[model samples]
Target: MEAKKAVRDQIISNHDIAEKFRLLADLLEIKGEASYKIAAYRKAADSIDHTPEPLSTLRQQGKLETIPGVGKAIAQKIEDLLDTGTFELLEEVTSEYPPTLRELLQVPDLGPKRVKLLWGELKVGSLDALELAIEDGRIYKVKGLGPKAIERIIEGLKSLKGRDIRIPIGKARELGKRIVQQLLEKTDKVEKIELAGSIRRFRETAGDIDIVAASEHPEDIIDTFCSLPMVQDVNMKGENRCRVMIEGGIQVDLICLPAQHWGTLLLHFTGSRDHNLHLRDLALERGAHMSEYGFKKNEQLITFSTEEEVYKFLGIQYVPPEMREDRGEIELSLIHQLPKVIRQKDIRGDLHMHSTWSDGKCSIRDMALAARSLGYEYICITDHSQSLGIARGLTPERIVEQRKEIESLNKELAPFKILQGIEMEVLSDGSMDLPEEVLRDLDLVIASVHSGLRQGREKVTSRALAAIRHPLVDILAHPTGRIIGSREGGDFDLETIFREAARTGTILEVDGDPNRLDLRDVNAQEAVDSGCLISISSDAHSIEGLYNMEYGVGTAARGWIRPQDVINTRPLDEMLKLLKRNRS
Candidate 1:
C-alpha cells in the first residue's frame, strides 16, 4: 500500500512539473517571447504529459532525451525538477509575474493576453485586484475593453469564485480508461482491472480515479502501471498497491489483490464513502466484519470472486454502482427493488444533434449513415435556428430546404429514419426564435437558451417557460447552457421548469457532449421525479460525436433514470407518437 501511494504521488508531482512548464510557456507568450522558444516549452510539456515511462526512471537511466520533444535543455529541466521538485527558470519567471496570476485565466472572457494586460498595465496581481480595477473604471481605460467587456469580466470573476475544483467525470473516465487499457496491454500478470470510486459510479465530476485489479504478481502489475505512457509521477509502489498521478493532475490508485478477493476489494474501493460505512454497519449486524480483502466472521475468512456473491452473502440485492450513493439505495436493496437504471443499449435514437446545415462538421447524409452504423433506429437533425447567426442558424426558407433534405434521406435510408428538428434558441424576454409555423412543421423541436444566459433568474426562467409552453417544442437541449468546469448554468429555478415541462409533455435533454452533459445528474433526477421524460442525445456535430451517447447513458444512470423515463429509448413508431405536436 505504501509503495502504491508513493507511485501515485510521483505521478502527481510529474503532472505538477508539466503544468509549471505549461504555465511558463503561457507567460512567455504573453510577454511577447519568440514563437519558437514558446513552442519548445509547450512541446516539452506535452511530451512529459504523455510520456509512458516515469521521468524519474528515465532520468536515472540517463535516457530522458529519448522521449519525443525532450531535447537536452528540457531533459536538464526534468532533472532539476526531480532533484528539487521545481526548476530555477520557473522560479525566476514566476517571480516577475506571480504564478497565481494564472488563476485569472479561469475567468471566462479573460484569456492569456487580457490577463497579461491586466498584470502589466493595471498591476492587477490577483482576482481581487482585477475586480477592483474593473469597478474603478481602470479596466475600461485598457485598450479594447468597453462597458460590455467590463460587465462580462465581473460575471466571469463571480463564476470563477464559485466554481468547484474537481475535474468533469467524462475527463476522469477517459483518463481512467487509458490507464486501464495500458495496464492490460503492458502486463500479463493481471487478471482483471476495473475502474472504481466516483468514476465507476459515473458521478458528474470526480476528484480522482480509483482502480482495482486482481493479480497473482502484484509487483509486476505495479511496475507496469508506473511505466505506462501518461504516468507523470509514481507516488507509491507498495507490494499490492500503487498510486500515481497521471497527466492533467488526476490521481489514479491501483490496488491489486489475489483473484479470489477481487469482488470484495472492488466493492470496498468503489465507494461513495457514506455507502461503504452503511454497508459496514450492516455487516456488523450480520456478525461479519467486511473489508477490502474479505469478510471476517468468527475468525473465518469469506471471499467472493463475483460482486453478486458478495452482495448475496450480505443478504441484499445487487445494487448498481451508480445507485450506491446511499440515497435510499440501501433500503431498496433490502427490499430487492433497486431501479433498473438506463443503459446505453436502451437508447434507440439521438434526437438532438446538428449537421452541416448549421455548425456541425458532418453532412446530413454522413450523420444519418453514422447513426445507422451505431444501430440507432433514428436520429434528429436539430440544426440551429436563425437567432444563433454565428452557428449559421437556419432561416425559415432554409428550414424548409432542410426538411426536404431529411425527407430525401428518409426515402434513401428507408427504415433508418431521419427526423427533422430545430435547436431553436429561446430569446431573452420570453420568446421563441422561429415562428410557430416553422416549428409546427418539424418532427421535433429542441428549444435552448444560447445567448443572454447571464440574465436574472426570473428572466431566464420565463424564457425557459415560454419555450416549454410552445406546443411544438418537443425537447429542451442543454437546458442550463453550462460548460462543465468553465461556466455556471444560468440562474433559474430548475424545479419550476421541470414541473412545467412535465405539464407540457416537453421532454428534457441530457446532451452527451463531454463538455456539456447538461441536465446534470442531480437536476436530471429532479426532472425525473417531476415526471418529465428525458432524451439522452449525443448532440453530435460529427460522426465521432455520436459515441458521446455512452457518457449520456452514464449520466442518466447516475440520475437513476430508467428506460421508460427516457423518450429516446422508445422505438421509432412509439417515439413518433410521443413527438406528435399538439396542433390545437
Candidate 2:
C-alpha cells in the first residue's frame, strides 16, 4: 500500500512540476525574456507532459534526458523539482514578478506581450486592476490600445467571471483513472473499484467524481482513500464513505461496500438521477423497493454482485452506464430492446486526421504507424487545404506530391492503408478551397468551414449545404466549430444540414478532439435520428491524439449511437463502398 501511494504521489508531483514550468515560461515571456529561453521552458514542459513514465523513476534511472525535448539543463531542473519540490531559478523569477500577474493572461486576447505592457506601464497586476484601468479610460493611453481592443478585453473579462466551474469529462476521466488505479493497487481486501456518477456516464462536463468499491474491509479502504496525496480537504469521514476535495478543487466521494452489495450500489450511484428514479418506479410496479443497498421484496432483501443480475431481478436487460440518462433507456430496457451501444473496440479506423503535409507534428508514415499500433485497419490523411495557411495547408501541387508519397507508403504498409484525403475549407461564398480536379483524385474529402463563422444563419447554412451536396465530399468535419468554454459554434441550421447530409449520403463527423467535440452528444443524437451517418474521428495531429477516439465513442454512446450508426465501425472495404456511394 505504501509503495502504491508512492507511485500515485510521483504522478501528481510530475504533473505539478510540469505545470510550474509552463507557468514559469509564461512569466518569462511576460518579463520580455529571450524567445529561445521561453521556447526552452515550454519544450521541457511539453516533454514532461507527454512522458508516460513517472519522473521519479526516470530520475532514479538517470534517463530523464532520454525524453524528447528534454536536454541536460531541463533534466537537472526535473531532478531538483523531485528532490526539493522547488528550484532556485523559478524562485528567482517569481520573486521579481508577482505570479498573480499571470492570471491576467487567462483573459482572451491578452497575451504575454500585452500583459507585460500593462504591468510595466500602468501597474495592472490583476484582473481587478485591469478592470479599473479600463473603466477609468487610462487603458486607452497605452500604445496600441483602442476602442475595439477595450471592448474585447471587457468581453473576455465577462466570460471569465461567468465561466462554468465544471470540469470536462476527459479531464475527469484521467483523474478518476489515476485514483482508481491507486486504490486497486493499495487496498488489500478490495474486490472491485468502479467510477460512478456523470463521469461514468460520459457526460460532457461533471460536477464531481464518485467512486464505488467492493471490499470486505470497508474501514481500511476509507482510511486509505482519505490519506491519498491528492486529497486537499476531507469534507466527510465515515465508516462506509468519505468525501474529499482533491488538489484541483474537484470533489470526489468514495463509497465502500461489501462485495455482495457492489452491483446495486454501483448502479444506484452511477445514475442520471432521473434514470434511477424511473428504475425505482419500475421496481415499484413489481412490488419491490429499490435502493443503493439492495431491492426489498416483501420483507426480504436481495443483493447481487453483478449489475446484470440486478437488472435481471428487475426483469429488464442491463442498461449501459452512458445510456442510463433518462432520455428513453428505461422504456427500451423494459422491452429488452436497448440498442447495442458502440464500444471503442468497434472502431475500425479514424477518418479525419492531420499529417506533416499540413499542421500535424508527425509525418505521414509515422502517423500511419501510430494508427496501426491502435489496431486500426486504415486512416485518412485529412490535412487542411490551401486556404488555412496558418496550418500550412497543402497547395494543389503539394496535394499531388502528398498523394504520390501516400501511394508509395501504402505499398510498403500493405494491409494497413493510408487513405489520401483533405480537410478542404468551405469559403464564405460556399466554394471549396480545393478545385474539383484535385479533390477528385483523393480517396476521401472532409469539407469543413474554417472561416467566416460569424455569417448569418442563411449564409452559414447555404455554405454548409453547398459542401454537403458536393459530390466529392465524404464527411463534414466539426459541423459546428465550437471549442468548449472558449467559443460558441457557428450559427447554422443543423437539422437542415443533417437532412441534406442524409439525402446526399454525406456523413457528419463526431470530432473526437476534446476541445472540439462538435456534433456533440445532443447534435449527434439529432443527426442519427435524421438518418445521417456519423463518423467518430480523432482529428489527431500527434500520435497521442489518436487515443482521443475513445472520447468520441463516449460522446456517441451518450447520444445513444449504435455501432451501425457510425460509419467507421465498418471495415475498410465497406467504408470505401459507402464513401463511393456518397460520391455517386
Candidate 3:
C-alpha cells in the first residue's frame, strides 16, 4: 500500500466490476433462481474479462456499448462502478441475501430457488436453520425435497462446512519452481527469486503465488519484466514493486524489496488473503498494520526482513503459506505437522490430448510441440474414435492410418515420447468403439460415454464397468461426462465405478478443460480411497489445449492426490510398461 503503487480506487478498468458481476452470476445460478438475469450479468462480466482494450480506455473512447455482450444497462452499470465503488442493482439483490444465506448457495444443492423456498415456506434463511430443518425432517417435509435430494443436501453441507479445496503440496512446488525458472530467464534484476507461498511448502493448488526478489538495480528488473513476452499486464510496477501475468494465465507478483527486507515482503504477499485479513485484525488489537509489507505499529513502520521476523512480531510461528488460508492452520501447525503437496516438476507426461483425427484443431505434431515446450517428457494423443462421429471420430481403418503418422512423428521426436492413445467410445451395449484387435494395438485407450447420460446410475455404471474391464481400456475419460450444469454424462455412480476401476487398474481421468473439470475433487478422493490410479489429464483437443493440463493438475491436488496417484507423472518407459502390461 505504498503511494507509488497502483490502488484499486485509481483503477478505472472494467476488470473489477466484470469480476464481481461474474461472481454474482455464479451466485445467482447456483441458487437456481432468476437464471436469465444471472445470464445477463454473466454475459456482461465475460465480455469484460475478454475485452481486448481496457474498459478504462474504451469508456473514454465512448464505445463500451458496441461490445457484443454489453448492452446499455450493463454499460451504464459499468460506468457507474468505474466512477464510484458501488453497483446499485447488485447491492439491492445482495441486501436480500445475508452472509449465511449467501454461503449456503455455494453448497451446490440449494440454489436461489431453494433458498427462496427455505426463506418463504420453511422460514429458514441460514445454514444453521437449514441444518436444523434437515435434522428435524422439515427439509423432506418441504415440497420437491425427496429422499435423494435430502441426502445430497446433507453431504453437500458437510462439503461446504469442511476444509475444502486442497492441492497436493508437491504440484504447487512444481508451478512455483517453473515460475522461478521463467523469472530467471526474463529478469536480470532478480538477484534472488523463490516461490514464497503455499507452493514453497508444497500445497495442491495455490490461491496465489509470491515471488520474492532482491536486487540493487530494480529499474533493470522492471524493464526486463514488463518487456518479457509473457508479461500480459503490469498490475503494478515501481522500482520496489512489480507484478505480471505468466504462462497459464497465473498472476505472479514479483516484489523488489531491499534484499534485507526480502523475507518480510515475501511473507506479506505470500499470504492467504483471508489469513492476512485476520492478521491485520490481530495487529489492530496490538496497534499495528499487519500487511504484506510489514507490521506498522503505532505510526511507525516497523519492518522485518524475513517471514520469521514478521511472524515473531505477530507472536506466532511462521505458518507456511499453504496453511495461511485462515483454515485454522495458524493454530494447527503449532500442535502437529501437515501433509506435503505435489509440484509440477514431478509431472512426467501430458496425458489426454487430442489430434486432428478428432475435434482437436491441431495435428499430432502440433500438440506434441506445445506439450514439450512445457518440459513434459511425454504426451498422449488420445483422439476420438468413430463412434463419436460428430467429433470427427476416426474409423478403425483411419486409426491405423493415424498410427502410421504417429510412427513418423515418433521418429522425429528422438528423445521425447508420444503415446498413441484413443478416446474410444463406450457403445450403448457396453462395448468399446474399437474392437479388441484395434484396442490392443495402442499404448493407451481412454474409454468414455458420449451419450445415454439420461439412463441414470444403473445403466451408466454397467457401461463404465464394461469399459473398465476391457483389457485395453487403460483409462476412463471424464468419468460422469459432467458438462458444468447443462449435461451429466451418464449421471454415473462414481463410487461403484471407482471400486471396479481399482480392481482392473484402469485410471480415472480429471479432464483439464475448465468446462469439464470432471472426476471432480469429491469423486476423485473417492477414487483415491478405492485405490484407483487417477490421471489429471487435459482432455485437450488442440495444441492450445495442452496448457489446460495445469488446471486439471490443480484440481487433482485439491482432491489431495499425490503425484504418485497420477499415471501421467510416471516417466515414458514406466508409464508405457504399465499400459502395455495391461494390454497383454
Instruction: List TM-score per model, in order.
Output: 0.80, 0.90, 0.55
**lDDT of model 3 at residue 161?**
64
> Residue by residue across 1-584, what tens digits does model 1's lDDT show?
56545544554445566787898997787666787888789767866766767787887799999876679988898876766656787888888898778778778988877888888788897888888887787888888677787788888888777766687887788678877877887778888889899888877788888999998988888888888877889998898888899766778899998899988898988868899999999899999999998899999999999888988987899888888889998898898898899988898898988898997867999999989998899998999999898789999999988878888888999899998888998988778888888887888889998778878999898999999988888888899999888877799889899999999888898988888888988889999999899999998877777888988888888889999999889998888777638423
Q: What's the candidate order when arranged by decreasing lDDT?
A: 2, 1, 3
The sequence of per-residue lDDT tens digits that candidate 2 reaches over residues 174-205 is 78987776677676688888889988888888
What value does the lDDT take at residue 206 in candidate 3?
Answer: 56
How far residue 348's Cα lies from its native spot in candidate 3, in Å, is: 1.4
Candidate 2 lDDT for residue 37: 91
TM match of model 2 to true structure? 0.90
Ranking by TM-score: 2, 1, 3
Model 1 vs. true fold: TM: 0.80
In model 3, how large is the Cα lDDT of residue 450?
80
- Which has the greatest lDDT? 2
Better of 1 and 3 by lDDT: 1
Q: What TM-score number comes out for model 3?
A: 0.55
- Quote the RMSD, in angstroms, for model 3: 11.8
